[model samples]
Target: MRINKFIANSGFTSRRKADDLIIQGRVKINGQTIYEPGIQVVDGDKVEVEGKLLTIEKKFYIKLYKPVGFITSNFDPYNELDLNDLLDIDKRFFAAGRLDKDSEGLLIITNDGEFTNNLIHPKFKLDKEYIVKIDRKLRASQEKKFEKGLDIGNGEKTSDAKLEYLGNNTYSVIIHQGFNRQIRRMFKVLGARVIELKRIRIGKIFLGDLKEKEYKYFSKDELKFVDEMIR
Candidate 1:
């Protein structure tokens, strides 16, 4: 198999990350350091990564309460706190989508790339709900803009959104689009900067009472619900 695909099938990391490992000379096949990303590997070839055996189990799915200022990556060049450090699991995982470092809340970590694609794909229409705190109060017209959907300014209009005021500069909203910095950009377009943004829900799964930086495994029923959501 292709080196990247082999690494991913071993559940070590994503195919892209596996390519990085190969390029960095950290991956070896049958005791030979393979720096070429295109090198293939067979079942009988012994593999080692960073002097550790390159063997891994199946995929995993987990939910974590991501605090602010941490990146959703296995490695960070800027010396930032990676999402892996927040979890104590033995298996390697990657974020499904991503939250900006300044934003916080529920983040899904999994080893299944296909499943992640389905969850984050725009065509699936999965709803991502957030509890947002804005810097200023929203006028009635601003609420109308949110309800009717606003021009995202890239010539693309955002989908219709649902908003509910939670009093004291806070409100909850559900949006189908997952564009980069979407919620922030939406509020920015409405002249209200987001003071705080927390993704409280994905699909029908809620964060419930999970505390800061805490994590949990999805129940069988919860997984079923998530699977059905993408269908």
Candidate 2:
């Protein structure tokens, strides 16, 4: 099979990212550096990524309610906080997307690299819902701007969004894009200060009574719904 396809099949990265690994000289085939993207590999050929043997076994998929103050990374060099410390596992897993340190809500940690790509890529157009509380009252004009997409710091405008006011400084907003600190930035652009932000849903999966700092695996039906949505 082609080198890129082989790397992708190993579940190390997507086909596009696999090409990057080849160009960076991080992938080797048969004990030789294989920088050519179109190189072929056969059975009995040894494949290594960044000097570690690549294996396609023991994939894991899990969901957790990420609490405030905990970083989303598997390890944090500065704060010495690691998400894995909360889980009982020896396998390596990565967060599919991200929730900022100050934000709290549903987060998926998994070893299934392919599922991570499909879930995060914009082509899937899956919706992520959040309930946020702001310090200032939302004005009517600001509400229209959110529906039409606002200029939130980036040179690009936010994608169309669904916003509903829940009264008493609370509102529910659903967005398709997962830009960095996107929900918080949008509110800031409207001259509002966010007091709290929590993601409540990802696609058909809901936070579902999971308390802060709590965790649970995706149910069979929830996993099936996600698979069908992306497929």
Candidate 3:
């Protein structure tokens, strides 16, 4: 198998991240540091990432209701709260998709690197649904502009989005792109500030009754749609 895939299969991280490690000379095969991501590995060849031996770990798929004030990462430089603290599982896992520190809602946690790549890759075009509360009511013209797309600075125009106006300055927004602070940036261009943002769904997976700081393993039925999509 390719070096990146081999590392990913070992449950260290996603293939993309593994490639980064290879390029950074952090990956070694039999004590030889390698800078090539495409190197092949065969049986009996030992691999080490960051000087730690790699081993295929049991895979886990979990859905978590991430609350505000927690970063969706394994480490934070400023010593802020991390989502991993809420999970009691002993296995190392990472978020498939991320929510900003101020945002809250559904998040997928897993140790399967291939699965993470497939779920977040733009080519799949998975629908991500969010509930956004802005500082003020949305105007008709602003809504039209938002639906058509806007230039959220740096000459980057957002794609067309679907929006449903719920009562009290809240709206249901659906987007496929996973740009950084995308929903918030889209609203900012229309003279609105997102007061609260919560993701409620990703494709067919719903947050449902999952409360903040709570998580559960994906049931067989829930995995059905996800598996079919990634495949």
User: Each candidate's TM vs. the true structure?
Assistant: 0.74, 0.81, 0.80
Instruction: Give the number of the best model, judged by TM-score.
Output: 2
lDDT of 2 by residue, 1-231 (tens): 888867766778877788999999999987899788899988888889899887556555677898888888887778655586667768777888889989999898777666788788898888999999999778999998987898877586798999999999999999989889998889888899899999988888788998977788878887896567434
Candidate 1 differs from the real structure by a C-alpha RMSD in angstroms, to one decimal, of 6.3
* Per-residue C-alpha lDDT of model 1 across residues 1-231, encoded as one tens digit per residue: 777767765666666777888899999888889988788777788878777776646766788899998887878887789876798877657888888888999898887765676678788788889999999889988998987888778877888899999999998999888877888888899899999999998886778889988999888877886567434
Each model's Cα RMSD: 6.3, 3.3, 3.7
Q: Which number leads on lDDT?
A: 3
- Cα displacement (Å) at residue 56, model 3: 1.9
Worst 10 residues of 2 by lDDT: 222-231
The lDDT, on a scale of 0 to 1, for candidate 1 is 0.82
Q: Once model 3 is optimally superposed onto the true structure by TM-score, how far is the C-alpha of residue 192 displaced, in angstroms?
A: 1.0
Give the C-alpha miss distance for residue 217 in model 1, angstroms: 1.0
Q: How accurate is candidate 3 locally (lDDT)?
A: 0.89
lDDT (0-100) at residue 228 of candidate 1?
Answer: 75
Candidate ranking under lDDT, highest first, comes to 3, 2, 1
Which run of 10 residues does model 3 get worst, by summed lDDT?
222-231
- TM-score-better candidate, 1 vs 2: 2
